[model samples]
Target: MTSLLRILRFAPQLNPLYLGIAVSSVLAALLSLATPFLIGAATDRIVDAVAGRTGVAEAVTAVTWLAVAFLAVEVAATAVVSVGGYWGDVMAARMRTVLSTRYFEHLLHLPQRYFDTALTGRITNRLNRSITELTQFLQFFANNAFTMLITTAAVLVITGFYWWPLAVLLAVVFPVYMWLTAKTSTKWQVWEGEKNTEVDVASGRFAEVVSQMAVVRAYNRQEHELAGFRERFTKTVGLTRTQSRFWHGMDAWRRLAMNVVFGLMYLIVFVRTAQGLFSVGDMVILLQLMNMARQPIFSMSYLVDSAQRAVAGSKDYFAVLEEERERAGGRALEAGEVRAVPNGPAEARADVVEGETVPLPADVPAVRFTDVTFAYDDDAARPVLDRVTFEAGVGEKIAFVGESGGGKSTITNLLMGLYPVGDGRIEVFGNDVAGLDLAAVRGSIATVFQEPFLFSGTVRENIAYADPDATDERVRAAAKAAYADSFVEGFDHGYEQIIGERGLRLSGGQKQRIAVARAVLKDAPILVLDEATSALDTRSERLVQAALEELMVGRTSLIVAHRLSTIASVDRIVTLRAGRVEEIGTPAELSRSGGIYAQLLQLQQAGTKEAKRMLKEYGIHG
Candidate 1:
C-alpha cells in the first residue's frame, strides 16, 4: 500500500480525477444506504394501516415519495460510477504513454556498462511488463480502493442507526482484516518479484539462442543448446509455480475467513430481528448493508493480489528509471567553426593543453585512448581497459589484432562514449571527450559494426540513416563510393527496395556495403570500421576494401580485422594483450622488429602447416 502511494507520486496529474471518483463513489454508497431505510419506513407505514392506525393516508403518501426518491438516488449513483469508470480508463492510457516514453528516454541515456551486464530481451520485457501492471493499478486499484472505503463507512454508519453493537463489532474486525491483508500481500509481493526476474532470465536465454542459431547449427550443437534452454525454462517454470501456489493458498484462507465472519454477522442480525428489535424491513436493510461490507472485503482481498503484481512490475520499471544517464555535466561544447588542418595528420596534436597532453587535431585520429580504464562493476579489481593508451591518426589506419576478450571493442565503446571513463581521461578534438556533447562527438564519427543493423524500411532509408536529410544526389554518390550503387541498381526496386528487420532479407556482404554507404554519406571526420569486410567473400572484400580506402583518405580510420592480409595496408598496428597495449608502431616497423605484431605477420605468411603450428602454440585458429 505504501508502494502504491509512492508510485502514484510519479503521476500527480491524475490525482484530481482520482479524488473526484472517490467522492462520487462515497456519495453513491451513502445514497445506497437510503434504499434500505426507505423500505423499512414504508413497511412500518403499511403495518400502521393494517392495524387501524390514524392518518394512514398521509403515511402512504410519504412512503410513496420516499420510494421515488430512493430510486432517483440509485439512478444518479449508477451514472456517477459509469463516469468514474471512463475517467479511470483515460488515466490508465495517459500513464502508460508517459511512463513508457520516459522509460525509453532513460534507456537512451544510460551508460553502456548497463547494457554489458543486462540483456536486451530482459530490458525489453521489464519495460513491457511494468507499463502493463502500472496501467492495471491505475485503472482498477484506485477506483476499487475508493469503493471499498465508501462501502465500509456506509455499512458502519447504517448499522449504528438500528444497533450500535453490530457497528462496533465490525469496527473491531476491520484492523484484523487489514493486518491479514498486509501480511499475505507482503509474502506475495516477494514471490512476485522473484517470478518477474525468472521470466526475464528465461526470455534473455531464449532470445540469445534464437539470435545465434546459425552458430549452433554450424557447430552441430543443436542438442546441447536445446538442453541448456530446457534447463533454464524448467527453472523459470518452477519459480512461477511456487509464486502461484502461495498466492492461491493465501486467497483460499481469506475466502474461508470472510465466509465465517459474514455468517456470524447474519446470525446476530437474525437474533436481533427475532427479539422485535427491528421490523422485517429493518432486517432487510441490515442484511443489505452487511452484504455491501462483504463486497469490499472480497474486493480488498483481490486488490491485494493485484497490488502485489504491480509492485513487482514497478520495481523493474523504476530500476530502469533510476539508471544513471550519460553525465552531461551541464557543459555544452563551444560551437566554433570546425576547420580542416592542411599539411597535417588531421588528428589532435600530442601537446600539453592546460597541463594535460591532448591528441593532435591535424591527425584527426580515428580514436585516441589515453590511460583509459573502465569496469562494469565498481568492485572489479581488473579493469576492462587497464590504463590502455594509443592513437590512430588521419590518413593513418590502425587495426586491433588480439585474441577474443582482449578489450578490442571496449576501446571502441569508450571512444564512442558508450561507456564512461573510470580512471584516466580521453580526448577527441582538443577537448575532453567526457565533457563533449555525446551527440556532437558521435556526429563527427561513423561506424559500421560487424553485425549491421537495419530498420524496417527501404534500402534508401537504411543508407540515409547517417544523414536523414541527405539529398538523392548525395545518397547516390555515397552508394557509388561504397561500390553498392551498381548492385542496388541491378535489384528490381533499386534504391526503393525494402529491407526486412535487421536487413535479414539481404546477404551479409550486401548489408555490410549498405552500412558502408550509410557511413560514407555521413562523411564524418573519424571512422570506426569493426570487421567491416570480414563477412565479405574474396571478390567482395577486394571491392569493399577499395571503397574503404577512398573513404579513409582524409579521415582518421580505425579498422578491426580478423584476416592478417586485410590490415597489411594500415599505417600502424597495435597489438593488445589482456586489455593492455602490448605493442604500438607502424606495420613495417613492428614487422621488422619481431614483436607480437611481427610474429602474427610471420605466421600469416607461413603455409597451413606452420600456421596450424603457430595457432597451436598461441591457441588461436582461423
Candidate 2:
C-alpha cells in the first residue's frame, strides 16, 4: 500500500484527467439510477391503462421516447467510460516511462557494491511488474472504486422511492462484503509477493544457465538445471493455485450472501404489494434498484483484489526506486589542451620519450587518492580496499600487479567514480571525483578490459563506439594504429562487416585490436589497460603490445598485468596484497628484491619452460 502511494506521487500531470474521469463516473451512475425509474414509469402507465385511468396509445408513445432516451444515456455513459479508459492508458504510459527512466538513471549512479549484491533479473522484474501493475491499478481498479462509490450513492437515492427497508438492507450487506474482500485480498497479496519472488529466482537461474551454456554442457548438468527450474516452477504454480482457490471461494461466498439478501428484498416487496403498501410498478422499481446496487458490490470485490496485487507489485518497484544513488559532490575536471606527442618506433631514446610527455596543469595530478577505504557492505567484515593513498604525476605510466582479489579493479572503479568512497577522497585531474559529473569523469579516460565487449554492429561502428561522432579518417587511423586494419581489410565487407553478439564472430585477437582502436579513437589523456592482452596468442600479443606502446607514449597509463613479461619494460609497478599496497618501485628493483613480484616472475619463467617441454614431448616445435 505504501509502495502504491509512492508510485502514484509520480504523476502530478494526470490529476486533471483523474478529475474528468471521476466527473464522468458520477454522471454515469446518475444515468444508471434513472434507468430503473424510466422502466417503472413505463410499467405504471400500463397499470393505469389496465385500470382505465389513461389510454394505452399515449402510454405506448411515451414508452418509445423513454426507450430512445435510455439508449442514448447508455451510449453516452459508455462513451464517457471509454474516454476515461483512454486517458488512464495515456497516464499509465507516461508514468511508467517516467519511473522506468528514473530507475535506469538511478542504476547508472549506483555503486559497484550495489550491483555485486543485486541480481539483474530481480531488478528487471521489479521495474517491469511494478509499472504494469501500477498502470492497471489506475486504469481499472481506481476507476471502479470511484464508480462504485457514486453508484452506491445513486442506489441509496433510488431505494428511497421503494422503501427505507431496502436501503437499510444494503447498508448492512455492503460492510460484510467489504470485510470479507479485505481478508481474502490480504492473503492473496502475500501469496502474490511470494510468487513474484519465485519467479525472480527462476528467471535468474535461467539467465545464469543460458549465459554459461558451454560450461553446463561441458559438465553435463542439463538434467540438474532442469530439476532446479522445475522445483521453482512447481512452487510458483502451487502458490498461485492456493491464492486462486481462496479468492474463488471468497467470491462464491459473497455471491451466495448477495443472492440471499436479494431474495429477501424481493419477498418483502411482494408481501408489501399484496398488502396494498405499494403498487406493482413500485415493486418492479424496488427489484430494479436492488439489482443495480449489486453491480457495484460485485465490481468492488474485484477492485479490492486488483488493488492488493498493485500494492504488492509497487512495493517491489519502489524498493529499487528508493535506493540511494552514488554520491556526487566535488569539482569538475578542467579540460586542457591536448598536445600531440610525436609517435615513433619502440627504440626511441628515453629522454625523447620523457620530453614528449604532455604536461598536466598545476592544479591537477594525473590521479590522487587520499585516505581512501571501501567495503562491500556496512558490516565491515572485510574491506575491499583500505586507507589506499596514492598519487600519479601527469603523463606517468603506472602498473598494478597482484593476486586476483587484490583490489586492482576496485581502484579503477573508484577512479572512474562508479562507487562512492567509504572514507577520504578520490580526485582525478585536480577535481574530487565524487563531486564531478560522472559522464564527464568517465569521458576523460579510455579503458580496455581483459575481455573486450562489442555490441552487434559493423567493424567501423564498433571502433567508433568511443567517439560516436568520429570521422571516417579518424576511425581508419585508429584501426591502422591498432594493427586492426590489415585483417579488417581482408574481409569482403572490410570495415562494414557485421560482428555477431559480443563480437563472437571475431577471434580474441581481432576483438582486442578493435577495442584498442576504440580507446585510441577516444584519445583521452588517461588510459587504463586491465590485462588488455591476456587473451591473445603470443604473435597477436606482440602486435597488439606494439600498438599499445605507441598509444601509451605520452599518456598516463595504468596497466593491470597478469603476465610478468608484459610490464617488464614499464616505468614502475605497484604490487598489491590483501587490498593493500605492498610494494612500489621500478620493475628491476622489485624483481631483484625477491618479493611477490619476484615469485610471479619465477612462476612465469617456469610456465614458459613447461609449455616448451610439452611441445617437445609432442614432437612439434619450431
Stretches of model 2 off by over 4 angstroms after superposition: 330-360, 377-382, 457-462, 471-473, 486-498, 603-622
lDDT of 2 by residue, 1-622 (tens): 6666667676677678767777777776777777777888888888898899888898888888888988988898888778777766777678778778867866765666678878776777777887787778777854566778887877776686568878888888889999888878877888998999988887777877876788999999999999998999899899989989999988999989998998898899889999999888887888888887888888877677778878888788767656665543343222121212223234542322211223246667788888788976789787988788777777888888766767887888788777677898887777676655555567678898888898899999999998777799999999999999999999889999999878878999999999999989988888988878877898988888888989998888888765666678788888777777788889999999887777666655666877545423322121
**Candidate 1 error regions (>4 Å):** 45-71, 214-257, 330-367, 373-386, 402-405, 490-496, 563-565, 577-583, 612-622
The lowest-lDDT stretch of 10 consecutive residues in candidate 1 is 349-358
TM-score of each: 0.84, 0.87
Per-residue lDDT tens digits for candidate 1, residues 66-112, read 88887898898788778878777887887788788778877876776
**Candidate 2 global CA lDDT score:** 0.78
lDDT of 2 at 335: 18
